[model samples]
Target: MKILQIINSLDTGGAEKLILETIPLFNKRNVQTDLAVLNGFDYPFLKILKKLNCCSIFSLGNKSVYNPFLIFKIRPLLKNYDIVHVHIFPSLYWVALAKMLSFSKVKLVYTEHSTSNNRRKRFIFKILDKFIYSFYSKIITISPEVDTNIKAHLKYNNDKFVLVQNGINLDTIKNEKPISKKELLPNLENDSYILTQVSSFRYPKDQKTVIKSLKKLNDNVVLVLIGDGPLRNECEVLVEELNLSKRVFFLGIRMDVINILKASDIIILSSHHEGLSLSSVEGMASEKPFIASDAPGLGDIVRNAGILFPINDDSSLAKEISKLLENSEHYQETVTKCLKRANDYSIDKTITKEINLYKSLLEK
Candidate 1:
C-alpha cells in the first residue's frame, strides 16, 4: 500500500520531525510512503529529508502555508495514494476539503498534535472544526490528553479516534556523541552547567518563562535555546532587556540536536501546553534529567519519570534545577528514570501501530 504524509512544512517542530523519522521506516516495510507539503520552504528539516532520498517529495508550489486556494491544488494529489495522512493545521483543513471536493475513495487520516490551539478558544471554530473533522476516516492522537481534548472540543464520541503517542529513534540518540562543552560554549568555564531547550519559539512554547528562570539560577548556569520561529526576535529582545545577553545563547536551528542534548547538564521544556512533546521524550531519551512545565501533554509524560514545575512558575523551575545540581544522587536517579521511560515510546513500536491502522482502514 502507498501512503502520502501531508503537512504545512518540514520546519522545526514535533510533527515535522515525526514525518522525517517515519517516512524512511515506512518505505523500508515496502509500504511505499511519500511526503507532500503546502509550503515548500528551504528549511533545515527539508534539507535533511532530501539527503535521505528515501521517498518522493511533493510541494504545492506556494511559499505561504495557509492559502485557501491550496484546496484546489491538493485535490488532484489525493487521487495518487491509498491513504493521505495529514498533520498540523491549515494542511489538515485543506486536505480534508480536498478529499470532499474531489470525491476520492482514498482514506484520509489526521494526527492531532496538540491539546490546545487558538481555534478551540472561539465558539465559532467548534462548528467549523466539526465539519472539517467529519471528512477524515480516523484521527490519531499523540497522547491521551490530545485525544480527550479533541473529543471534548468536537463534542463527538466515535471509534475514529485512536491513541498513538509520538515516538523517537532511541538508538540514534544513544549512539550520538555529545559535542564537547568547549566547542558548544567557548566563553564559559569548562565546569559550567548547560540547560538546553530544543523547541521552536511558538505561542504554545514558553521560552520567556525559561529565560526568566535563568535569572534566578547561578551565574555559572547557561541557557541554550535551539529552533526558531516568529517569536524568536521577541525572545532575543527580552534576553537583552534582562541583561542576559552573555548568559543566553540562541543557536537558531541545528540538525545535530541529539548531540547537543547529550552534551547538556539538564534538558528543559517550558511550554504552555503540548500534545505529547517529542522534544520532551527526546530529552528523556538523551539520559538527561528532563525538566518541563506541569502542563497537560507534557506533565503526563514528565511527572513521575522526570521533573515538573508549576506552569509559568520560574521560581519553582529555578528551584527544581537547583535541586538537580545540588544533589548528585537525585540527578542520577532522575536520569535513570527518564531513560527508562523514554524506552517505552520507541519509534519502531509507534510505526508498527501506525502501519496496522492504515491497513485496517483500507481493509474496511
Candidate 2:
C-alpha cells in the first residue's frame, strides 16, 4: 500500500510528532509512505525522519496556507498514492480543492487532531466546514472527546468519523537511562520533587499556571517546563516575577523526553484544552504519578490513571502536587494505574487499527 501524509509543516506539535512516529511503523508493515508539507520550513524532526529512512518528504515551498499555489503542487502529487491522509487545518481546505481540481481517484482521509476547532463556532466557518469535509473518505479523531467535537460541526459527516486513541511506542523508552536532577539542572539539591509539564508554550497549555503553582508548593519542589513557543518568553517573565527563577527550569525543545520523564517524580498537564495529550500518555508509560487539568480531551484520558484539578486553579494544582509528594501509598497507586492506562494506548494497538482501516478502504 502507498500512502501520503500531508500537514502544515514538520513542527514539534502532537499531530506532527504522531505522523513522524506512525510513518516508520507503516514501513515495518511493508507499506510505502510519503509526506507533503503545505507551508515548508526546516525542523529538527526532518533529521529524525531521515534516520528512520521511511517517508519520502516533499514541500510545496509556500510560506502561507492562504497561498493559492498549493492546489497546483498538491494536485499532481496525489496521483502517485493510493491514499492521501491529511492532518491539521488549512491543509485540509487546500487538499479539498486539490482533490477536486486534480480529479484524483485516490482515497482521502483526515484526522481531526484537536478537541475543538475554534473557528467551527463561527457561522461562516460552520457552513464552510460542511463543504470542505466532504472530500474525505474517512475522518479519524484522536479521542472520543475530539470525535464528539467534530461531530457537532459536521453533522452530516458523522458517518465518516472514527475514534482512534493516540498511541505511544513503549519500547522506545523501555531501556532509557534517566538523567539525575543535578545533571538536568545545575546546583539543584537532592531530595527535590520534580513536577514536569511536557508541552509547547501555546494556547490551551497553561504552563504559566504551573509556574505560578510552584510558589505555593514547598521550597524543595521544582517545576520543569519542556517545549518552546510564542508564550515561552511570557512564561519566563512570569517565572522571574514570581521569584521562581531557581525553582522553575525551562528546558526548551528537547529530544531527550524519555530520560527527562524517567527522572521526574511527577508529570502534569495544565492545559485549558487538549486532544488526548500524548505527553500525559508518555509520562504514564514511564510510570510517573501524573496530574492534569480537568479539560475535555485531557480529562477523558487521565480520569482513571492520573489526578485532575479544576482548570487554571493554581492553588488546587499546588495542593494536588503536595498530596502526591507527601503520600507514598497514593503515589504508588497512581503509578500502577498509569502503567495500565498507557498499555491501552500502545503503538501496536494504534497501528493495527490504522492498518485495518486502510485495508477496509482499499477493499471498497
Candidate 3:
C-alpha cells in the first residue's frame, strides 16, 4: 500500500507531531509512505523525519493551493500513490479537491484534529466540510468531539467518522537516555515542584493563563514552557509582569518534550481547545497528574485523571493548581488514575486501528 500524507507545514503542533510519530510506528511491509507538505517551510521535524528515513516531499504549493492549478499537480500525484492521507487545515480542503479532480481510484482519508465552538462558523464549516469533503473514502477523527461535528455536517456516511485517540510511544523515551534530564530540565533540585507544559505558543493556548495561575502560587514551584509561536513574546512579557521571570522558563520549540515531561513533577495543559492532547497523553503515560483548561475535547481528556478549570479562568486555574500542590495524596491518586487512563490510548491500540482502516479502504 503506497500512501501519501499531506500536511500544511511540518510544524510542532499536535496534529503534525502525531503524523511524524506515526510514520515510525507503522509497519511499512512493502507499503511505501510518502509525506507531502503544502505550505512548505523548513522546520526542526524535517531532520527527525530524515533520521527515520521516511519518504518526504514538499510543494511550494499551486498559487496557495485553493486554485485550479492545484489539481493539475496534486491530481497526478494522487494517481501515483495508492492511498492519500490528509491532515488538518489546508490539507483537508486541498486533498478533497485533488481526489475529486484526479478521477484516480485511491483511498482518501482525513483526520480532524480540532474542535470549534463558534456557532457562526458552524454553518459555513458544515457546508464546506459536508459538500467539498464528500471526496473522502473514510473520515477519521482523533477525538469523538469531532465525530459529533462530522455527524451534524455530513448527513450521509456519518458512520465514516472513526475515533483514534491520539497515542504515545513510551518505548521511544524509556530505553533512550531521554536527552539527559538535567540538560532538558536544568538546575532543578529534588525539593522543587516542577510544572511542565508543551504546546505551540499560540493564542488559543493562552500560556498566559498558566503564567497568571502560577503567579499566585508559592515560590517553590517552577513552570516550564515548551513549543514556539507568535505568542512567545507576549508570554515572556506576562511572566515578567507577573514577576515569574525567575520561576518560569520558556524552552521554545523543544525536540525533547517527553523527556521534559518525564523529568517534571506534573504536567499542565492550558489549551483553549484540543482534539486529543498528545502532550496530556504523554504526561499521563509518565504517571503524572495534569491541570487543563476546561474545553470540549480537553474536558474529555481530563475527565478522570486531571482537574479541569474553566477556559481563560485564571482564578479558577490558580485555585486548582493550589489544591493539587497542597494535597500530596490527591496528587498521587490522580497520577495513578491518569497512568491507567493513558494505557487505554496506547500506540499499540491506535496503530492497530489505523492500519486496519487502511487495509479496509484498500479492499474497497
lDDT of 3 by residue, 1-364 (tens): 7788888778888787777877766635455677887755667886688677867565646345445555556677787777888887666777787777767788898887777644316667767777766888878888888778656657766577787877877677444443454675577665677888888887568788888887777787889898888989999988888888888998888776776777777788887777788887777777667878888778887787778888888889778777777899998998888877777777767777888888888887
Top-TM-score candidate index: 1
Q: Assess candidate 2 and give its lDDT.
A: 0.87
Candidate 1, 1-364: lDDT as tens digits: 9999999999889999999999999999999999999998878889899999999998887568778899998998888999999999999899988888899999999999999999999989888999999999999998989999999998767697999988999889989999988898889886689999999998889999999998999999999999898999999999999999988999999999999999999999998899989999999999899999999898889889999999989999999999999999999999999999999889998999999999999999
User: Of the candidates numbered 1 and 3, which has the greater TM-score value?
Assistant: 1
Candidate 1 vs candidate 2: which has greater lDDT? 1
- Regions more than 4 Å wrong, model 2: none
Q: What is the Cα-based lDDT of residue 333 in candidate 2?
A: 97
* Location of the lowest summed lDDT over 10 successive residues in candidate 3: 173-182
Number of residue pairs clashing in candidate 1, backbone atoms closer than 3 angstroms, sequence gap of 3 or more or interchain = 0
RMSD of each: 1.0, 1.3, 2.6
- lDDT string for model 2 (1-364, tens) is 8989999988788888888898898888888888998866777776688777777888898488678788898989988999998999889899989999888899999988898767877999988888999989999989988888888778864678888888878888677888887889877788788888899888988998888888888899998888989999999999888999988998998888889998999999899888878888888888789999999888878898889999989999999988888899999999999888888888788888888888899999
What is candidate 3's local distance difference test score? 0.77
TM-score of 3: 0.90
